[model samples]
Structures are given as structure tokens and as C-alpha cells.
Target chain A: MKDLALLEDNAPKPGLWTQIAHPGLFLGWSRHLIVPLAVITAALAAWGLYLSFWGSPPDYQMGDTVRIMYVHVPAAWLSQFCYAVMFASAIGTLVWRHPMADVSQKAAAPLGAAFTLLALFTGSLWGRPTWGTFWEWDGRMTSTLVLLFIYLGIIALWRAFDDQLKAARFVSVVTLVGAINIPVIKFSVDWWQTLHQPASVIRLDGPTIAPEILIPLLVMTAAFSMLFLTLHLVRMRTEVIKRRIRSLELAAARAAAGGAL
Target chain B: MRAFLAIVARDLRLGLRQGGDILTLVLFFVIVGTVLPFAIGPDRPQLARLAPAIVWVAALLAQLLSNERLFGSDFEDGSLAILRHAPLPLEMVVGAKMLAHWVLTALPIIAATPVLALMLGMEGETLLRAIGSLVLGTPALVAFGTVGAAVTVGLKRGGLVAPVLVLPLSLPVLIFGTGAMAPMVPGASGQALLLLAALGLVSVALVPFAAAMALRFAGE
Candidate 1:
């Protein structure tokens, strides 16, 4: 009943959206998160977009087409990274029973799925002119497709449950257990001879790409991270509101049942 | 030990009384394997080259189909509650159930692989490797499959959803199973069997308890 005060009092307020959506609380959830994130994202995007189109050197072999790496490589990184986030969140939620862990995990799923699709599409696009085929059943590509399926499966399992709590727990288990595939996706190229290039950015000797390319790739990575943050926050707020509405409806139903009795 | 064996025998008896559960899974494996060559064309060399991977994949898929049998009916009937409350730990009960499942589903796949290999024109050393890999790898299938089955046991339409949850975790088996047989294709046997054996050992040690916990959660 005490928790219901916010719902009972605020449900009729039209001006609540402006207050709830205030960027201050969004950014203030963690101290100084938004400012640094905004600065880094803007700087990187500007630098990367400039170099990708105008400044970065063309590969001696691939020419202008190599620019797509600025997009494709970062997307590939984020797809894997987002899944890791989902996986870690899932584990945290399950083991510690952190409520936000569930919220963040659910929020991360669609974001991860989107990144996976973009990675696949971009990889296919890059493959067309480079590999002379739109796709290869090579270890990396095949594993990426598998990763996408894992994402879809998690999301599907979550949506299938009527109770959000039950669904969250189910999806959490699936994500944590399926974390095995992340390493496979990351190291698939090295483990198996594949058309996809071996790790260039995070290798032991360090990134093989020049600063020009690396800068943009890092920029794109930041942009992708920020995009994930923005979207997840929005989605989590939506979930919290939806849960509020559901509880209110249940309360109303109980009250009506009591009145009839 | 009696508790363990009793559970195993009980599951085996249940599987038998159900009459066609084990046979249907084996039949599904053979039929799917046979149909694939037809669908893809009967190129003998190609089939021979793919025989190990194909047989393993078919076995894995068929293993997925049989997974629903692991805890589905028992969970629904509240027998699982009795098992959980029994003096025997839930882990041992799950372990016994998983072993029985291996004997029923995986053993058939392994037994039929030699025949399936012959049909695909796999010869001599390759055939041996294929069967050997299945023998080593199938336990992992049961281990992880039991985990997935436990996780989904209380949900509606759990049977359809279990494979999607299980398949990714089972990749080590698929990878090592196929990898182990790779050398036999070229007339040599290699680390695939070694890795397959390792995965089986690890899964046997770890998966049962994890699966038991998952079953406890689903039951809740």
C-alpha cells in the first residue's frame, strides 16, 4: 500500500512524463555517466565519420571498399559485447536477485539482437566484394548466425511467459547457460580456418590496423555503447511503467471482487 | 548406490512401458540421416566426407527430440517432488535419470552410427572413429540435455522450447565429436577423441547437480 502511493497519486498527472523523462535523473542514476558518454560519443563519431569517408588510407588490395570495416568491425564487436552484457546481467540477476539485472537483461536483448542483425548484414555486405560471395559457412560467419539465434531464443523465451518475473528468470537462465557461445564466436576464426579475418584489434601484439582505422573503430564502438545505454534506459522505464499499470489493474480487479462479495 | 540404481531402473522401466519412446528417437535419427542424403543427393564421396559430422548432427538433433522425455512427464505428475524430497539427493536422481537417458537415446544413436556410416560409404578407420566419437560424446548430450529439460520442465510447450535452450550448450560435444572423426577421414585418428572424452568427463561431473538445481527452480 505504501508503494502504491506513487501510482495512485501520479497516474493522473499529464505532466509526469516531462519530469520522469528528465535527462537529469537518467544521467544522475550514475554520477557523471552522461557527460563523459556524450563527449566521447560525439568526438569519436565525428572523427570516425571523417576518416572513414575522407582520411583513412585505402587498402592496397581492397581500395575504397575497405572503409566498411569502420562500420562492420565495430558492429561485430558490439554484437559480441552486447551478448556478454546480457550474459553477465543474467548471471547477476539470477545469483544476486538484483531487480535491475532483470530489467537490464530484458532491455539488452533487443539491443543485442539488433546489433547481431547489423553485424550479419554488414559482414555480408563486406563479404560481397571482398570474398566474391555474399556469405561463407566459415567458422566466424556461421558462429555469428548461431549467436543471433541464441539472442532470438532468449527474447522469445522471455516474451512467451505471462508473468514478467517468471519470464525474466527463464531468460536469465537461458542467457547465462548459453554464454558458452560467446567465446566460440569471438575465437572462431583462430580455432578454424575461415574466410573472416583473424583478430586484428585485440590480439596479443596489439591492433594491426593503423591509428586512422583504429580511431574510427573505437569511435563506432563508443557510439554503439551509447546507443545501447540510451535505448536500454528508455526500455527499462517502459517496463517499470508497464509493471505499475499491471499491478494497478490487479488491485482494481481485487477491489471489484470484494465489492461483489 | 541402490538408490541410484533404483532410480535408473525406474526410469528405464518407465521408458519401456511408454513402449516407443526410445525406438522412436532411434528411428528418427536413422530416418533423418537417410533423408538428408536423398535431399542433398547421393554423392558417395560427399556423403563419406560428411558422414561423421552428419551422423553426429543427426544424433544430436534426435537427442534433442528425446530430451523432453527426461523430466517432462514426471514433473507434471509430481513424481519429481517425491524425488526431490527423497533421502537420495536430487543431483544423484538427476544423474541416474541422465544416465538412463543416455542408455536409451544416445546408445541407439551410437549403435546405429556404424550402419549409418556404411550407408554413407564411410569405411574402416573412419567408421570406427565415427562410432568412437559418438560413444564418448553422447554422455555430454545427456548431461546438458538434462539441464535444459530441467530448466523448462514446468512450462507449457516445454518440449518445443528445450532444444533451442540446449543446443548451444551442447556445441562442445558437436565440435569435438566432429573434430575427433576428422582424422579418421584422412586415415588417421587425432585429438577429437581426446577432447570428446574430456568433455564427457567434465559434463558428467558438473551437469547433474546444475540440472538438479534447475529442476528445483522450475518446480518452484
Candidate 2:
């Protein structure tokens, strides 16, 4: 009995790190940040549009269609960024067992999918005027398509499980496993594109492109990043509240059962 | 070591005794291979051109057909529980099961590839390269599929989930496998073959630990 009592007394408690990482602590702060984040995103987006449409010069070779790069490139960057965040959250779920990590991962999937779809859509629209074809199975395009599929797969895995906790862990493992393909996709797509079309190699940010184009692209990228952060924070808060409600309902059901008995 | 061999032997025996599924996998491969020429028209040159891709895709799908059961039956019958409690590492248990799966499913597909190559009108050097690619690539396929199967083993309809989860992960294998047989690419085939072997080696080295963890989670 003494040993048992000592064991009880020495039981592990949530550490300082977990306490800091807890979603509830951020709940009030997130609500406050959302409005400011939205305003910043909107202001930047409006400024970005002004620069992209009016301030930026038309490309010497491609002309006005160069403006499409403002949307397509930023969406492409965010798609990869979102996956990287999900991958980090996966590591958190598996290694540190962080409570909020899985919630963040689950919240980020649809956003990543949306960004990937926008990249593909805007890319194809840009392609028709530039490449004379709307779609080409080149390395970058195909890999982006595969990335979209992966995002959908993760989302489907999230929906497949009825239990959120189990779903989170399973999704984490899947995310880490899928993380293996991200670099391969990037490398192979670049290599494939270079091999098939040696002349028309699309550089991510080449020095040849004037600074006028670069500034708007950077602004647009910032705007997209801020938007992702705001959405991710809102979704995470929703997930936490949903989980709390679920647990309360479970406890209430147990209490009612006990009373009836 | 002895426990690993025993688990492998036990699974192999169970697979051989229940061989109907093996037959189904083979038939699936043959049917998919045979139907492609008809769907694409009986153009001999086109069939020859598509033969390597067709064979690789069929092998991928056929191998996938059996992955859901890689751990499902053992898990359902409580054999996996006994293995879990045994005096051996769970990773070894998983490796042994995956090895048995490759033996039962992938070996038959490899053996049947030359025949599928013939049906697709591929000949001589192309058939040889196709076989070489399959031999090097299938281990990776089976390894990743085992991970998928382990992840979904707890679900009642995990079989459906296995392909979606595994297919994207297997893209590199598909690309390199087909790349290995593309005659138009001068020195690329050799590089692709080496990469495919590397992928297989990495998958062989890494997947068991991941699969074992997934199994443990499912067991919980």
C-alpha cells in the first residue's frame, strides 16, 4: 500500500512544454489574431493585385500572361508549405505525442488540397496561352497532380476513421510515409521538365526576370502565407472545441447510464 | 532468428494451403494484360510500345489485390496476438510476414511477366529489360504495400483503403521501373535500374519498422 501510494504520488504530469503547446491556451489569442490576420492578408492581397496588374511590366517574350505567375507561383509555394507543416505535425504526433499536433495536421489537409488545386488550375490556364496546350504530362505538372492526389488521400484517411484520436495517429503515420515522395516529386519533375524541353525551362525565380516581377511575386507569396496561417489557426480552434464537446457528451452518456442503473 | 524463420514458414504454409487467392492474382494479371491490347486496338507497334508499362501496372495492381490480407487473416484469427506476445521483436515478426507475402504473391507475378510480355507483343531485349525491372521493383512494391496493409488492418474495409494509401508512395517505383525499360532513353535505363534497386533496398530496410508500429497501433 505504501509503494502504491508512492507510485501515485510520483505519477507523471503534463510538462511545461505540453502546457505551453496546449490548444486551449491559444484559443483566446487565436480569436484575437484572426481579425488582424484577415486585415493584413486583405491589405497585402490588394497591394499585390495592384502591383501585379498595373505596376508590373509585361514580359518581353510572354507579354501580359506573365501576370498569371503572381497567382500560380504563390499557390504552388503554399501547397508545398502546407505539406511541410503537416509533415512537421506528423513528427510531433509520432515522436513528441503533442496533443495539438494531430489537430493541426487534420486542420491543414483541406487547405493544402485547395492550394494544390489552385496551382493546377491557374497553371493550366497560364499554359494554354504560353505553351499552346492546356495540359502537359511534364515532370512538374504530373508531380503537382500526384501531390494533389496525396492531399486527397490524407483527407480521405481522416474521414475514414470514426474515432478522432485513432484517425490522428493513423493520418500522422501516413503523412510521414508520404513525406518521402515530396522530394522525389520535386526532383523528378524538374529533371523530367528539363529533359523534355531544354529551351523552355521554367525557373522558379531566375535573375533574368526583372525586379518588377519579383516584388509582386514576393508580396503575393506573403499574402498567401498569412492567409494559410489564419485559416489553420481557426480550424485548429474548431477541432479543439469539437473534441471537448465529444468528450463531454461521452461523460454525460455514462452519467445517465449510471443514474438509470 | 529461429522465431523469424518459424513465422515465415507458418505464413508460407498457410498461403500455399489456401492457394485460391494466388490463382486469382495471377488471373487478374493475365486478364488486365490481355484486355489492354483490345482496348487500345490491336496495333502491334503500339502494343509493343505499351508492353512494359502495361506489364508493370498489371503487376502493381495484382500485388495490391493480396496486400489487404497480408496481416488481415492473422490479425482476425488472433495469430497476430500470439506473435505480438512472443519472445521476439515485432519488427522481425512484421518482416517475416512481409517476406512471406512477397514469396507468395510477387514471385508468381515475376514468373508470369515473361508470358505477359509475350501477350503484349514485346520481344527479346525489351522482355529481358521488363523482367529485370520487375525483379528489382516488386520488393519495394510489396514492402510499401505491407505498410499500407498494416496501417489499415484494423478497419473492416481496409482493403479498399490500401491502394489509395500505397499508390502515391509507389510512384517513384513506377517511374523508375518504366524508365528502366524505355529504349529511347540512351543511358538512362542503367541509371533507372540502379535507382529502382536502391529504392527496393531502402524499402526493405525501413518498411518493417513502420509496419510493425502500425500493427502495434492497430492491436491497441
Candidate 3:
């Protein structure tokens, strides 16, 4: 019992670490965090854009057209990353019942969809110049299209419910199910792509891509990741405030009814 | 086990009494399949090339159309609530409902595939392979659709949401199912069939638990 007391005394008081860990505590600091995050995002995006456009050289074969990768690859990466965020949030909602999980998941969907759309659009633009078509049933592109659809489906599911809590639970289940199916979908699409197109140009053998091109790609990816973080944090803070406003209105209405009664 | 079978029997009987629902699904399948020849022109070779894909797509759509009603009616009428309180586990109840749904909806569509295949100018070995693929694939479809139906059961516009939720997940089934029927693939058909069966078995074994959890959450 004395040893337990000593251990308890030595333990850090639920201060900065606790505040960082607790979603509700972070809510209080959201306003403080948002500005810095937004500024960081903007700065990184500007730098990344400059690097991609001027600093990087045109591809040996594709020339200036390869620059589309700066936008497309990053958006594609964030598209899947946002789904992964939602997937983790789904597990949090279902398994641990995290208060902020559903809000995070719901907030992330539209952003994911936007990134996915950007990826598809840029990919098609790239394809028109390269493959001579706006669309190709290539594995990565098709699977990403399906991912966009899944994101849309989840957003629609969220809209279908008037009760946000109920929608959260339902969407969480669907998101987790989608997460499980994603690998299967990708595998099948890869198989299907192989059947139709034997030679794929998107091989990632290190020596093939020059350092100058790869650097911009990485920088752009970092910029996109920062952008997602900024957006997600802002959205989550907004969701929290929205829920608070809703409850306050409901409480006020109840109090007014009680006074009348 | 008895209670499980009883739920299955009851759902089956309820489905049979509403037999027109099944007929409508089959007719929709036929209509969708029939439209392809006209839409793409009556070029027999083109239709033959496209037949497996058309049939699989039609089957998927037809299955999706029926999924909205899988748990919606029970949810609305409060039977699902009573079933939740029954001795049988909700997972088993879900399994039984999916089984009933497969029997009532998917089997009829699979049975109607031969006619649709004929209309598409697919015959001989290819038709047999198509039928074989549909038989193996539709259970997975029904399983996936059940999960969609259960997830959306409490929503007012559940029918609208079910397809969006289910269709992407069904793509693999469509890919493998059509691949199984492709005559040009030679030994690929056997491999595709094995994969399709594996998908079906996985869906059957695991999807009901997910559906049951969704149903319980929706009920709450």
C-alpha cells in the first residue's frame, strides 16, 4: 500500500499529456491548433508546388506531363490515407467507443471523396496525354474509382439518418466492412488488369525514377498529408461545436416547455 | 438449432407467400439482360463476347433490388425486435434470414440465367460455365446484400442506401464470376470457380456476424 502510494505520487498529474490524449481536452485547444496547422499547410503546399513546377526536371520520356504526378500521387495517397483514418475511427467507435471517433470518420469522408476525385481527374488528364484516352480500366485507377464510390456511399449513409448517433454506428460498421473488402477489391482488380494489359508502366524500381522527380513527389505528399491534418482537425472542431449547439438548443427548448407547463 | 431452422422456415414461408416479389426480381433480371442486345446492336459475336458480363451485372442489380426488403419489412413490423429476444443468437437469425433470402431471390435468378444466356446468344460450353458461375457466385452476393440491408434497416430511405453500400463490395464477385465463364481463358475457368467458391464460403461463414451486429446496433 505504501509502495502503491509512492508510485501514484511519482506518476504525472493528468496535465499536458492527459490533455493531449483526451479528445475533449484537445477540443478546448482546437482553436489554438487550427491557425498554426493551417499556416503550416499553406507554407508546405506553396513550397511543394514550387518544387514540383520549377525545381524538378521534366521526365526523360514523358517530359512535362510527368508533373501531374506531383498532384495525382499525393491526392491518391491521401485518398487511401483518409479511408484508413476512417477505418481506424470506425474501430474506435465500435470497439472502444471513442467520443470523437464517429465525428472524425464523418468529417473525413468528404475530404476523402474530394481527394479521390482529384486523383481520378488528374489521372484521366495524365492518361489523355499518355494512353490517348480519358479513362483506362487499369487496376489502380479502377480500384480508386471504386474507393470513390465507397466514400460516396458512406456519405450518403450519413445523410440518410436524422440521428447522428445512429448514423455514426451504422456508418462505422459499413466503413469497417469496406476496409475489409478493400484489399480483396484491389487484388481482384490487379488480376483483372493483368488479364487485359500485360505490361504496366507504373513500376517502382528505384533506379528507374531519378532523385529530382522523387524528391518533389515526396514533398508534395508531405504537403497533402499536412493539408489533410489541417482539414480534419478543423472539421472535427466544427463537428464538436455543432453537437454542442444542437444539445444547447434542445435543452433550452425543454426548459421553455417546462416553464410553460 | 431448432430455433434457427424455425426462423429459416418462417422467413421462407413469408417469402413464398409474397411470391410476386421473387417474380419481379427475375423479370427485372430478364429485362435488363434483354436490353443489352438492342442497346449494343444485335451483332451476335459482340453479344456473345459481352454475354457473361451482361448476365453477371443483371444478376447483381436484381439481387441489389431485392436486398432493400430483406430486413426492412421485419424491422418496420417489429418482428426483428422479437427475434432479437428469442433463444437463438442474433448471428444465427441473420444467417437464417440470408439463407432464406438466397433461396427466394438468388436461386430464381440463377435458374433464369439460362434463358438470359440464350437471349444473349451464349450456348454450348459457355452457357454451362455461366450457369455454374452464377450458382457459385450468388450466395456471396446475397451475403453481401444482407449486410447492406441490415446496416440500412433503420433508415427511412434504406432502399436508396443499400445499393451504394453493397455494389463496390460485389465487384470482386462480378469479376471472378464472369472470369469463370470466359471460354478463352481455358484453365482459368477452374481457378476462377475455386476463387468464387472460396469467396462464397467466406461470406457465408463471416458476413452474418457483421450483419447481426449491424442489426442489433440499428435496433438500439
Which is the leading candidate under DockQ?
A: 3
Looking at model 3, give its docking quality level.
Answer: medium
For residues A54-132, what per-residue lDDT tens digits would candidate 3 score against the true structure?
Answer: 9999877778998999999999999999999999999889987765788899899999999999999999999887887
True interface contacts retained by model 1:
0.15
What are the candidates' individual DockQ scores?
0.36, 0.52, 0.75
* Residue-level lDDT tens digits of model 2 in A98-195: 76898899999999999999999999988888778999676777889999989988887788787878877888888877887678656655655544
lDDT of 2 by residue, B1-220 (tens): 9999999999999889999978888989989888888889989999999998899889988988888889888899898988988889899998898889989999888888888887788989988898899989999999889888888888876667778988888888887888888866578789889989998998888888888888887887
Q: Encode model 1's per-residue lDDT on B10-39: one tens digit a residue.
A: 888887787687778878999888988988
Give the total clashing residue pairs for model 1.
Answer: 1
Q: Write the per-residue lDDT of candidate 1 for residues A12-60, one digit (tens) a residue.
A: 5335553343322333353345556666667777877887888778877
Tens-digit per-residue lDDT, B1-220, candidate 3: 8998998899899889989888998999999999877899989999999999999999999999989888888988999999988898899899888888899998999899889988888977889999899999999999899889988998778778889889999999999999898756457789889989998999888888888889989888
Docking class of 2: medium
Query: Which residue pairs clash in candidate 3?
Result: none
TM-score of chain A of each: 0.78, 0.88, 0.89
Model 3 stretches astray by more than 4 angstroms: A1-24, A200-207
Candidate 3: Cα lDDT at A257 = 93
Residue A61, model 1: lDDT of 75
Looking at candidate 1, what is the lDDT of residue A156?
69
lDDT to native, each model = 0.74, 0.85, 0.87
**What clash pairs does model 1 have?**
B180-B192
